[model samples]
Target chain A: MTVSIKITSPLTNADVEKLRAGDKVLITGVLYTARDAAHKRLIELLDKEGIALSAGKLPFDIKGQIIYYVGPTPAKPGQVIGSAGPTTSGRMDAYSPRLLDLGLKGMIGKGARSKDVLEAMKRNKAVYFAAVGGAAALIARAIKKAEVIAYEDLGPEAIRRLEVENFPAIVVNDAVGGDLFVQGVEKYRGTGND
Target chain B: MRKVSVKDITAKVKELCIAAACHLEPDAAAAIRVASEKEASPLGREVLAQIIKNFEIADAENVPMCQDTGISVFFVEAGRGVELDGSLEDAINEGVRQGYKDGYLRKSVCDPLKRTNTGDNTPAIIHTRMVEGDKVKIKFAPKGAGSENMSRLKMLKPSEGVPGIKGFVVEAVREAGGNPCPPIIVGVGIGGDFEQSAILAKKALLRPVGGKNLDGDVAGLEEELLKTINGLGIGPMGFGGTVTALAVHIETYPCHIASLPVAVNIQCHADRHKEAVI
Candidate 1:
């Protein structure tokens, strides 16, 4: 069974724990956007923290925050953002576990995640949600405000803080090891009624 | 000999690029509408409805339907009797650079190893063919990485034949699951040498979505593959319902006696492409 839920960020352990795979969620809050390049730089920054070389701090604190994996097109005049859709999440699997361990509560992207990331999500009480992969124009409508916060040199891959309202997503992985992709494929397999 | 100036080509390419980004092809839009009505899962139907709405919004707002406007790929057929005013390749690349810049399309091309953005989305992948006429026809396809990454090519034993081909195609989609995005269009290229087969598969995608191949037997095979794929229950967005694939397009050519090459090019629902004649 599926339920519709509205969530506001920054999320909490209790909020993520309440979600189940297959839940339809409307997220209204701030979402941080970053893609592969930004993720790599972020991890490098985290690594530098131990060296004491004066790299300073992360652009934004990630604890209990959601990061959307996206590299949007340039916005036109009068637009808050351009067509902004989720990129494939599997590309970020290498860095996800570390971010989740650092108190990142949620991730928004399309496609599957690695097992290691899923396990980390379970351990951290975090959740993985999927925004529609190719519905960029429609998704951009939900983003009320957008501004670059870090890695401005990375072009579209730069991290931006987005103020969104009623942004839609589906919970694909929950804290309890529930996976919508596996269950959904199994349930409808061989049912060629169409 | 007839001459087509580089300026004319640039203008046409720019127009096609913007049009492709903003508009969902009529055939693709209609197919999604039909899929929504036939979808068995409530979630699947809803996803399809949202896709339809996205198309409507993209067209109205003049925004790209998806953020990854993709690497520009062109298929050009030039007439033997036509003379070019300038280097055809440079003109196409310049057109792509301008189109991406002016249209607000994303520049996705990068150095695979060095990982540097080209910024202008230049040096498009251009394939050219010579024909008898005096006019040139150009087809532009902006292929996103999500679906392009999922594409597969297999060199099968000639003995494996049709059943083997079918199995390979089915398995690829099943493994792809939701990554390529559900309700995809599968392009299959059969026979030909390895590189030729891959190009054939991509060219097959230019065929109208849901349109039948000219050959009856091939069309029948396409139908069979479509039914088998949808039966896997991948559903829309892999959310678990009906309508996994909207169409399967196959293009075939003669090949070596011992080798059978097959390539699958998967396309997401956005299906951004356009054509022009000069």
Candidate 2:
């Protein structure tokens, strides 16, 4: 059975703990957008900051925040944002573990994550959600506002903060190591009886 | 001989860019609708429903169906007797630049290593073939990287044959899982040289969804592959259902006796493409 729930971001450990693979969610509140390019920059900034406290710092506070993997098309006049859908998540696997360790709680993107990412999520009590791939126009409707916060020169790959309402996604991975992709495929395998 | 203006070609290409971005081709839309009806999983059904609604919103609002407006790839059939005043390639690039800018489409092209945006999605991948008529026909397929990245090609030993080809195709989809965004359209190219095989695979996707191949034997193979793929339960977005692929299109050419080349070009459900003739 599938259950639908509403989640407001800057998510809590408790909030993510309740999510499980197969649950449908409507994520509201503020979500940050970044794709492969932005993620690489973020990781680099963090590394440069080093263990020793320096004047250098991350551009934005990532703790408890949810990052959406996306690089939307430019908006037309009178539109808040253009078609904004999730990109594939696997490409960010190399940088995800570090972000999760920084207290990032959730990720919204399509596709499976690497083993390292799943392990990191398990350790950090993070969750992974999948917005519909290629359903950008419908997904953009949920975003009420958009503003670039960093890496403005990256064009579409720039990091933007979005205020979203009722943004639909399904929980593909949960803190406890649940993965919907594996479960779903196993359940439906050979059901076609070919 | 018919005279075709480069400006006219540019205009047509511009119109096609926007059209392909905003509209989900009718055949693909129909396949999704049918898949939704046949989907057994409640979650899979819901995903398909959302896809249908997404296209509806895209059409009504004049927004791109997906953010990745994609790499502009054009297949041009040039009439041998037709005369053009300007370079065909430059006109195509100009068309892409104007279309992407005017249409507010994402400019995804970059210098791979440097990762600098081209800003105007220019220099489209154009494949030209000389045909027997005086009409120039163009087909534009805006291919998103998500599916394109998952596509595969292999040099198979002739002894591997049909069974080998079948296994390779299925494994590619299985490995792709949800990344390519199933219910996909699989285009198979068999028996060409390395580069030719890859191009053949992509070209096969130009065929209308749900249409059968003209060759009966090849058509039969398409059906068999389709059934086997759906059986893997990749489903819509890999959430699991009975409709992993809407169609399997195969294009074959004669090859050297010792070598067999195969390529699989997977296209997501969006399948954005359009065509025009001048």
Best by lDDT: 2
> What residue pairs are clashing in model 1?
none
Per-residue accuracy of model 2 over B1-278 as CA lDDT, tens digit each: 78999999999999999999998889999989988888888999999999999999998888999999999999999999899999999998999999999999999999889988888997799999999989989999999999999999999999999999999999999999999888899999998799999999999999999788899999999999999999998889988778899999999999999999999999999999999999
Task: Give the distance in Å from residue B115's predicted Cα in candidate 1 to where it truly belongs.
Answer: 0.6
The regions of model 2 sitting more than 4 angstroms off are: A1-3, A52-56
Model 2: pairs clashing at backbone N, Cα or C within 3 Å:
none
Please provide, for model 2 over A55-106, each residue's C-alpha lDDT reduced to its tens digit, 9 standing for 90 to 100.
2366778888999999999999999999998899999999999888888899
lDDT of 1 by residue, B1-278 (tens): 99889999998888888889999889889888999999888888888888999989999988999998999999999999999999898989989988999999999999989999988988799999999999999999999999999999999999999999999999999888899988899999999999989998999999989888899999999999998998998888888877899999999999999999999999999988899999
Stretch of 10 with least lDDT, candidate 1 chain B: B233-242
lDDT (Cα, tens digit) per residue for candidate 1, span A1-194: 35669999899988998999999999999999999999999889888786443323678888999999999999999999999999999999999998887889999999899999999999999999999888999999999999999999899999999999999999999999999999988888887443
For every prediction, compared with the true complex, DockQ reads 0.68, 0.70
Judging by DockQ against the true structure, name the best candidate: 2
TM-score of 1: 0.97
